[model samples]
Target: MADLKKTELEERAFETAKTLLAKYQNPHNLKLEENSNLEDCYTILITLLYAEILEETEQLAILSIIDGMKLLDGNR
Candidate 1:
């Protein structure tokens, strides 16, 4: 899905995830602004891919962010 086109919101969420993942070594330190779409994206990502975050898999929390877009897109 690397070549898949991402909407602006998706891109924002992806970037946010990457930034947060990079700033903190542990997922527990990550925080999202509540009651916003960005937070919603993070919620989906965490719910679906928390294990990956906990494992620090591939150093790419962006994967979860991308996958979270699928859930959001499906709802739309």
Candidate 2:
């Protein structure tokens, strides 16, 4: 079965990423800001939540995060 909560969080993170990507122009600064949003946006919030789950505790969660990031990149 699919992990619906994880999927929903991914969507929220993607949306937050979209908004940040639109407002920021520099890649360096964008990454910095995005990192900061971990305290403020769903992107970081969701990842942090998932990161705590035993299933996502593995390093491959990094890949999952990257894939979610691609969704933002592809849309923009």
Candidate 3:
């Protein structure tokens, strides 16, 4: 399989985050800021309502989170 360029990866992350954000009822009408970096965007989304956000993102989020955990665990 071909590797994705940085831009392609970032774009995919942005789209996935946007789709996840849309699932929230968002009483505050929170929006992902254009000026914020990807990490910040993800932080806001995940922190807003952790479990719900994870649930909304579903399989992709689960796999990514597990992968991240493994990386962190290995690094420790």
Candidate 4:
């Protein structure tokens, strides 16, 4: 049961990331140089897009807080 839930969550995250990548990579939205390598562009774009999403969602902030708490506890 837990495994099924984890799998579903993973799938949803993957689909969301794919959608984000497609949106950023849409030729109509993004202009590139003729010599640009699309594969490299995509790799960079996806990393940036995911980081944007994490920041926008405040997930990164929450994770940072959690890590801070762990560090403080460990020092005690």
lDDT (Cα atoms) of all candidates against the true structure: 0.56, 0.46, 0.56, 0.44
Summarize candidate 3's per-residue lDDT along 10-62 as a digit string, tens digits: 45445655766776566656577555555655554455545463554464653
Clashes of 3: 0
Error of 2 at 52 (Å): 18
Q: How many clashing residue pairs are found in candidate 4?
A: 0
Across 8-56, the per-residue lDDT of candidate 4 in tens digits comes to 3233334444545555545434433333343434443455455554445
What local lDDT score does residue 20 receive in model 1, on the 0 to 100 scale?
51
Q: State every prediction's TM-score relative to the real structure.
A: 0.35, 0.29, 0.48, 0.30
Flag the better candidate by TM-score, 1 or 4: 1
Backbone-clash count (model 2) = 0
Off by over 4 Å in 3: 1-6, 27-29, 48-59, 62-76
lDDT of 1 by residue, 1-76 (tens): 4655656766667566565555446535444443345666566456435544344563355565566667877999
> How would the candidate models be sorted by TM-score, starting from the highest?
3, 1, 4, 2
- Ranked by lDDT, the better of candidates 1 and 4 is 1
Give the lowest summed-lDDT range of ten residues in model 4: 3-12
Please name the candidate that would achieve the greatest TM-score relative to the true structure.
3
Alpha carbon lDDT at 15, candidate 1: 62
Q: Candidate 3: global Cα-lDDT?
A: 0.56
